[model samples]
Each structure stands twice: as structure tokens, then as C-alpha cells.
Target chain A: MTNNSSGSRFGFLIPVIYIVFLLLPIYWLVNMSFKTNSEILGQLTLWPTNPTLRNYTVIFTDPAWYNGYINSIIYVVMNTVISVLVALPAAYAFSRYRFLGDKHLFFWLLTNRMAPPAVFALPFFQLYSAFGLIDTHIAVAIAHCLFNVPLAVWILEGFMSGVPKEIDETAYIDGYSFPRFFVKIFMPLIASGIGVAAFFCFMFSWVELLIARTLTTTDAKPIAATMTRTVSASGMDWGVLAAAGVLTIIPGALVIYFVRNYIAKGFALGRV
Target chain B: MSFSWMAWTLPTAIFFITIFALIAALGVWEYFSPGGGPRVGILRFETTRGDRLFVSLLGSAFIHLAWLGLGGPSLWWALALSVVYAIGVFRFV
Candidate 1:
């Protein structure tokens, strides 16, 4: 009994240590963001000697810096919305139906997800150019959908399959039309699935850089792309760059915070 | 940094606004008539109005892309095709 208690006491230590390890770089980035460029380039310190908000000020005040953030949010939101909207029905089809070659088709969709973004970047660039959509927010949003849609479909399918077939039948028999049933009854039942799917879609589109950078130029340049400006003729603006990095983490953190419960339930197959 | 990158084209702004409007309209419609029950048409699988709308939008995107690839300089045919395709998806898919 004493051994078991000792073992349980130490169990938390592993996760706590792991979390600190994971957080070290992020902590450093936040630390550096608060320091002046000279201090960042000077001797290493555990904490900033003179913490300043100058880096953040530069980003907020500069249109090029701030607009990058706006552009990124626009496309990421667009991609997430598109991905989840299309995936819902596709996931329903996959979970509930037994169509010909359904398994093969599903696997094919995943293969698209697995395909490297680099291979498609040039094609996407040319295609969007032809459509006169180069450097546009929609271009990046649509490009992201290639991967996001498949992932959303896959995640939602797992959750949908967890739902019993009888619930669907019962809803159908209760004088609920298909759309009404799906919206009012069926969707609420699998709300966690939708949340999880949307979260993944948002995360993927938000962090993905290769295709987004390849597809856009000045007009729709994402914040990640804008980070390049720090390396100008003056030299690397370490403070501002670090500040941008710190700021970039906020939206994603907010998303996870909001969907924390759903994510836990999602991983546990909708069971708390 | 340059502010030139900050300005979005009018078309781009209009495009986004139109999409948002459509989504808002969809939400309102769903709220008022939450019972557009599923129906199986030519596609065999059952679909609701929301599902049909989604499918049509997706299909229209592909139609426009295909036109860009194989059709002429004019996109009017593609737009016409998309409208027809959307109607078909609403009626059938």
C-alpha cells in the first residue's frame, strides 16, 4: 500500500516535467519579446534586464506587421468554416452509408491529407493565377481546404460512428425532416465531434506555412510570411520578431482554451 | 514595413461579404424552419437543405475551376453551369 501511494505521488512529476520542457522555448520567446533588441543580442539573461513593450508596439503600429495577422485570421477562419461545413455531410455519409468503394474512397481522402504541401504549391500558384486569384485571401483559404477538409471529415467520422444507428432512426420516425433532424436533433448529439473537427481545421490552417506562403504575395500575406520583414537591411529585429512569435500563439491558445472540454471528450469517444 | 500589403481589392472584400451574408441567411433559415427533413433523390443517399446547399457550393467551386482549366477566357459559361449545378444539387443531391 505504501509503494502504491509513493508511485501515485511521483506520477504527477513526469507530466509536470514534460510540460516544463515543452514550455521552455515558448517562455524564452515571450521573454525575448519583452527585451530590447540590444539586450536580446547582448549577454544571455534568465529574465529581461529592462523589459519593454517596444516590439509589440512596432507590430501593432506597423500596417505590414498587423495586416499580416489580419490576413492570416481571415484565411484560417475561411478554411475552417469551409472545411467543417463540407466535412459534416461527408462524415455523415461515411459513417452511415455503405456505398460502393466507400472504404477505398475514404482511404483516398486520407492519402490527400498525407500528401506533402510542397508538391501542390506550384500547381496551386499556377491555378490561382489563372483564375486571377493570386495573392488573394480566398486562394490561401481554398488551398488549405485540400488538407483541412479531409482531416475534418476523418475526425468527424470517428465521432459520428460512435453514435448509435438507432438514434438516427428514432429521429427520422419522430416526424423530423432530414435537415431538421440533422440540425435540431442529430447535430446536438454530436456537437463535441463538430467542435473537435473545427478545432483541428483551425489549427492546421493557422500553422501551415508552405502552401500559404507560396500562394500569396503582398496583398494576402500571412503573419508568418510577414515575419520575414524582420531580416531587413538594418539586421534581424529580434525583439519585434520574438514579439510577433508570441502574438502568433494567442489565437491558437484561445481556440484550445475554448475547446478544451470537447477535445478531452472527443479523444475519449464522447464519454467523459 | 510597407502598408501596400494591407489593402484588399474591392472584389475580394465583396466576395467575403457575400459569403458571410449567405452563411448568416443560412443560420436564420435554419432557426426559423429547423425541419427541412432529409430526402433521397437521384443521388440515393438522403440529404437535407443544408447538406444540399453545402454540396452545391463545393460543386460550384469545382465547376468554376474546371472551366478555368478547360473552358474559354469568359467565365460566364462556368457561372451558368454552376447555377444549373446548384439547382441540380438542391433538387437531387
Candidate 2:
């Protein structure tokens, strides 16, 4: 009993320590966001001596600032929806069937995911500009698909394969149409997979800066791009920047929370 | 006549539309004819299309990172290598 209790206590300590380590940066960001700019630079304090919401207030009042958040949310949602929708059938195909060069084709798609965003940024800018799409939410959404689609497909395929082939055949024999079978039966069975995929799609599209920044200017600028404005003639608006940073983490945190159960399995790519 | 698009440009609109169209096309194709059973590959073990995809993606990430670390002027070589590696993964892995 003593040995087992000690082992359990040790395991508990590790995660507790890990959680603190992970949260320390976030805590610091929240702390700095509440402090005045001078106070942020003055000394290291665990908590704000004089707490204020002026930084958040500035963000709420400014069109440039608040619009950034809206633009970000819009594109991230569009990307997540697009990625999962596209990936579903592709994942189904990969999971359920064999086709000539299917393996090669799937690999090629993943190679797009592996390709560095920096490499594509210039070409994407040029391509979008050629068609007159310099700064738009849709541009960012589509650009994000280059990575998210492949990842979504990979994740969903794993989940799909776990279902028995007999179920598909049985459904077909029972006169259920393919689309009906897929939408009504297969999808619900893999609901957690879809959730996990959407979570990743949202997370990546939300946090990605390079492609998002490159693809937009003032009109559809993301919060990450807008955050750059804090470094100005008056020196860095450290408080406001910290506040913006804190705000950026909220969407991702909420997503993780909603899909918390599926995340571990999703990260395992449903193989486990 | 000229008009300023609101927070959206032609390319942005086209890009998104094209993606959605492609997805629709895939759905149509799937409706017409369904997929087939898994086949054995060059690898000793049998793998479905999805397993090959997972391996290839994981491999490609490493290949790109290595190419970047090796100080190359262009990733075209890495791209080429990735193609060969992907083929190999499909064939053997």
C-alpha cells in the first residue's frame, strides 16, 4: 500500500509540475497585461500592484484592434470548416478503398503540409495579387487549407479505419445509399474524430502567423499582424501587446476544452 | 464600372470558391463510384491508404527540417527528394 501510494503521488507531482511550467508564461502575460507600461518595465512582480483593464479597454475601443480579432475568427472558422469537409470524403476514400497511385497521391498531399510556409508565402502573395486578392479573409482561409486539409485527412482516415468494413457492407446491403450511410451512420460513429480534426484546424489556423500575415494587409489583417503595431514611435506598448497576446490564447483554450476528451486520442492520430 | 470589394478581393474569392468546388467534385465522384479494398505493398506488412499517408507526412516533415538544417539555397532539391522518398514509402514502407 505504501509503495503504490508513493508511486501514485510521484505521478501526480509530474503532471502538477508540468502544468505549472506550461502556465507560467500565460500567467506572466496576464500579469503584464494588467500592469501599466512603466510598471511592466520597472520590476518583476508576480502579480499586478495596481491592476487595470486599460489595455483591454484600448483594444475594445479601437477598430483596428477589435477588427483584427473578428477577421482572425472568421478565417479560422472558414478554414476549419473547409478543411474538415474536404478531408472527410478523402479520408473515407483512403480508409475504405484502394485506387491506383492512391498512396502516392495521399503522400503528395501530405508533402504540401510538410512544405514550409515561408516557401509558399511569396508565391501565394504573387498568385493572390495576380487575381487581385491582396488582403482578404478568404485568402487566409484558403492558404491555411494547404496545411490543414492534409492534417485533417490524415487524422480522419485513422478514425475511419477503426470502424469495421462489415458495417459499411451491411449498410449497403440494407439499401442505404452511400451518402446517406456516410452522413447518417459513419459520421456519427466518428464524431470524436471530426471534433479532433476541427480542433486542430482551428488551432493551426488561429495561431499561424506567416501565411496569415503575408496574405493580408489592413483590411483582413489578423490579430497577430495587428499586434505588430504595438512597436511604434512611442516605444512598444508592452501592456497592450501583452493583453492582445492573452486574448489570442482564449480561442485556442476554449477549443481544447470543448474537445479535451478527444484530444489525447486525436494527438495519437486515433491509432491508439 | 468599378467597385471596391469589401474586405475581399478577386483572388481571395476565387481561391475559396475553387477549394469548395474541388470538395464538391470529390463528393460527386464518390457518389458515382465508391472506393475499393486495401492491397499489399512493397512493405512486408499490409497497409491501407491512410497508413501510407501518415508515414509519408511524418517522413516529409523530417526531410524538410533536414534540408533546412543542411543550409540549402533552394528547397527544390528537398522537394525532389521528398517525391522519391514518398514513392519509396508507398512502395516499401
Candidate 1 lDDT, A1-272, residue by residue in tens = 33666556678888799999999999999999999988988999989998999999998999988999999999999999999999999999999996544554686699899999989987777778777888999999999999999999999898889899998899888888989988998898788899989999999999999999998889999999889755574488889889999999999999999999987766676553
Worst 10 residues of 1 chain A by lDDT: A1-10
Measure candidate 1: CA RMSD: 13.1
Q: Score candidate 2 by lDDT.
A: 0.85
Instruction: Give the Cα error of residue A229 in candidate 2, in Å.
Output: 2.7
The whole-model lDDT of each prediction reads 0.86, 0.85
DockQ (CA atoms), all models: 0.02, 0.06
What's chain A's TM-score in each predicted model? 0.94, 0.93
lDDT of 2 by residue, A56-165 (tens): 99999999899999999999999999999999999999999976557757877999989999999887887787777779889999999999999999999988999899
Clash count for each candidate, listed in order shown: 5, 1
Q: To one decimal, what is the Cα RMSD in angstroms of model 2 from the true structure?
A: 9.0
Which candidate gets the maximum TM-score versus the true structure? 2
Candidate 2 C-alpha lDDT tens digits along B1-93: 123323578987995796467445544554465452346777667775456655776787789899999897698888788779978886765
